[model samples]
Target: MERQLPNFLKNYGSILLLLLGIVVGSIVGGFFPEIVAWLKPLGDIFLNLLFAAVIPLLFFAIASAVANIDGSQKLGRIISTMAGVFLGTVIIAALCTIIVLWFFPVDAPQVAQETADELLQGNPGDTWGDKLVRFVTVDEFYKLLSRENMLAFVIFSFLVGIAAMRSGETGASFRKFLISGNEVMKQLLILIMKIAPIGLGAYFAYQVGTIGPELFGFYAKPLGLYYILGAFYFIVFFSLYAYAAGGKHGVNRFWRNNILPSATAISTCSSIATMPVNLSVAPKMGIPAAVANVVIPLGTTLHKDGSSMSSIVKIYVAFVLIGWDFFDPMTLLTALGITILVSIVAGGIPNGGYIGEMLMISVYGLPTEAIPAVMIIGTLVDPMATLLNATGDNVAAMLVAKFAGARGTLSAADGLNTDDADGTD
Candidate 1:
């Protein structure tokens, strides 16, 4: 009887459960708002668990992936190709967003006078040089533990990985140890995820209940548009990329295997949370562990198609609210540059879109009063945006593997053993 359950549901049951939670929570919250409000802590605890795993998981996964690379020249080629593709795709996404916004302009909501006054008073003084300095160097080792310093940790990990790779036997031993640690972290993540449905349910319920259905009605037009465009990118853009990297069959297989991860990203609204699912499925999709390990972790930090799209939308919305001409050549240029930069650094941050919102304010020279307005748009569109980002990471991995001269599609045997930390047969 248990075996009679459908394969897709069994495989993606967590997402189903999460959706159930959302629906049920919304209903209960709608009828009895006070009870659902009390459930907020359940969701908060789960989110914290997910965030706790991110820093260590990223550090170990990335370092192990780089150390495991066969040689420096090969790693160089892979990294270069991957970076080019990542940037190109993000630019394309941003352009598409701009085009869409140009054709269908969204009216921005008015900010409260008090809110505007509060927002305009703060000074963020973070220049490009300051950001660069922060990225490349940490003032203290402990600073790396802070969520805002993820880029610094990534840089440090890359150097450690390269040094370990060059250390011959010593490096090899260390790499093994790092790999083991990564495995342990994956296991920890799995245990945390076991309770995700409850956490997500409580969270979504509280959100929907407190905000009420009127909130959706208020933002429906823009949110609906964002979801439609995001889906187009996920299904159309990714499928086309998959077809190019592999073929018709490869596209079919890639889409089939990606269901769970994409669903998870949409439900959780997190690319970081989706990493484990991507790592597990990459092998099944024929991506080499060496490539998946490096690319997926790195992509989690550097690649963010969903956030890029969301940023473009937010910037456009902000422009309309502020009465700025978005079509100006200089305006377009600035948006492109800042969106790309913000998307790259936005990953691994706990609040998702808060940092990106600040970058838009700083780079676009918007009034500090604009932050609340931009955040509203971000909150509305984040889930769909994250779905695109998480799914795009898998597509990026496949493309990187192909460009780096991986022989056609490797078998599942060539992939990582997702069941164990060591990934052994």
Candidate 2:
């Protein structure tokens, strides 16, 4: 009976939870608007628990992954792959920003003087020098990098992974420990997954009910644009890159092999939670365990293409709201460059979007109140952002796998076999 219960839950849990969150959140939003306040904390608690697990998971997964790389002679290849990822992300960001600016120019709307006066409240960060100083200081820096802090945690985890690779036997033991830890996390996450449906339902219901019909208009156009770009990038840009660089069988098969994991990431919107699936799927696509291990974990923190892109868009919206033209050539160029730079530097931190957007607000001398607007933007665009982010990571892993010359997917005789029927061919 005990064994039967585990199996039953394992099969049906996620569906159950999703329904529960929607029902609960919807009911709360519809009939208990006043009690909606309590539901907010419940949502926050769930997110916080998820956030708490991210940093440690990243640290172990990355270290273990790096330590397991097979080929000593492939260092140059790995570096080249890393370069591809960096360059590809920058290009994607530039393209996204330019396209959005050109197509979806936001018109300024006039609000009452009193309403504008009310919005002029709040302070974001500081002056350039002051913020830069704060950014570089050890304490603030640490806070920035922690998983809860996110950016700092990413930086530290990468350093630790590198150090672990060099530590020889201790590194091996630590790697084993990390692998074990990751498995444990996977089990715990499976448990969490059961409740996720409930949480998602509740959250969405609350959001839809509270925001009401008027809020729908606020997101309509921008959301449309976001989805259009998201699809274009995924289907055209990524597919082209994979095929061009990976060969027909190679890239196509890789995509097929890893679709489930990528889909999971899109649905969950949490890269850290998707790691177990990624690790399992990657090898099927011929990604070496070493490359798979290192790339996916590291990518979670660093390659938030969708998140950062949405952020830049939010700032543009703010500028539009403040009655500034968004397409002034110089302003456009500066915004693109700044978004990419700040996003990269702030990578690996918790809520890097928050920090990056705050930095942008300071840098541009924009009103601090813009943060709430940006937060709304982020929330609305998160699923698409997570999808792009997960896709980017997979592409990065493929490139790395190619460069590493790892054995698995190179043979044509495999005839599109995958580790699992759902994974890359």
Candidate 3:
């Protein structure tokens, strides 16, 4: 049992982490509440470092991808495919949030008004007009790029890369600089990678130390539910979508070919970190360079089905905990909008969700402290989300490969030659 357990657990780190988080969160919440305060700082430190790497990683990745496109720009096809997957994922996430709300129903147990009041009292914010003013200022614009607000950073990088590509010698030098910056960030990320396990462990320990055993009930089943929902959406719905968009072999070949990268993404829990593996595996999977180059990096920041799942689940938790009704169409629409917007905005930035949540808390007037609780639930399910996201990306890559008319090989899924299939969409 001991030897077998190791193998089983090795293939199931996400599940193990969920169990660890629950048992630990519960024990800590119940018995050692006092110590949670001390450990909280460690968790904060971990988040800070995690976020610090997000912007630079995104900047170089976007710049590098934009600089490498070949042939007549099939930009339209690429955008459409990405948009389809993204919108579909968002819709599915909204469904997940609603289901979670229906099942859990946070309002059944009334939360104290005093608790809500206390949270708001401590966290102040500007009015809408003030915020708009701040957002429009030139200083804020630069800060947005610097802060790694991925949407801005992506736009900035793409524009810069396109301009540089057009500028001949000067552009070549600029591209080199961006490439060099990316390499430097890569090295920094590698250093951070060594400590990731420690950070994960410390964050887990801190969460476990604070949340008592009773809270274990929250993660045990809901966590599993979220993972299964994410898998169903990607493996079933999105896979079918791939077949419709490209061909049967598109989904199958993509999945089988990129399984290693998918698994690496799940294990590492950092999609950005998994780029080398993804890039290396894409060609072997028969994906074209043009498609693979643009799709994967953009997908890492833009196409986050995993984070989408988290946003959906968290929205449901918010409504349920606040005792709001999910059956209301307005409520569902609000959740959907927030999930998509947050997914896009946050997916762009390095630790986009972390910052995005602050905006959410202020905008929606939800309990800010509850952010930690939502993260606890989301992080537990993140690995599964990553697997789903990686799978979706490969599927998209295959579709894009077909459209690009690049060197194609027989898809591993059904032994069909995509290049010879002769398809027009």
Model 3, span 375-401: residue lDDT tens: 566556767776766656666666556
Tell me the lDDT of model 1 at 387.
86
Window of ten residues with lowest summed lDDT in model 2: 107-116
What is the Cα-based lDDT of residue 248 in candidate 1?
A: 70
Instruction: Estimate, for each residue in 1-425, the C-alpha lDDT of model 2 and write its tens digit.
Output: 89867755654454445545555666667767776665555555554554555455545545555555445524565656765675567567666766776777654444412244544443466676865444334475446444333434545656766776678775687767766875665555455444444445545555556554343455466667777887777777777656654677666665776678667766665666667777776766656666776677667665667765776677777675555556788667657765665545444443445455555565466654354445456656766877777667777777667655665533422465454545643
Measured with C-alpha atoms, the lDDT of residue 106 in candidate 1 is: 66
lDDT top scorer: 1
lDDT of 3: 0.59
What tens digits encode model 1's per-residue C-alpha lDDT throughout 59-138? 77667766776753357767887898799889999998988878877653343222334434323788878856864578
**Which RMSD does model 1 reach against the true structure?**
9.0
Model 2 lDDT vs. the true structure? 0.60
Candidate 3: regions farther than 4 A off = 1-29, 48-114, 121-168, 186-212, 246-302, 314-375, 397-425
- The top-ranked prediction according to TM-score is 3
Candidate 1 colliding pairs, count: 0
Cα deviation of 218 in candidate 3 (Å)?
Answer: 2.6
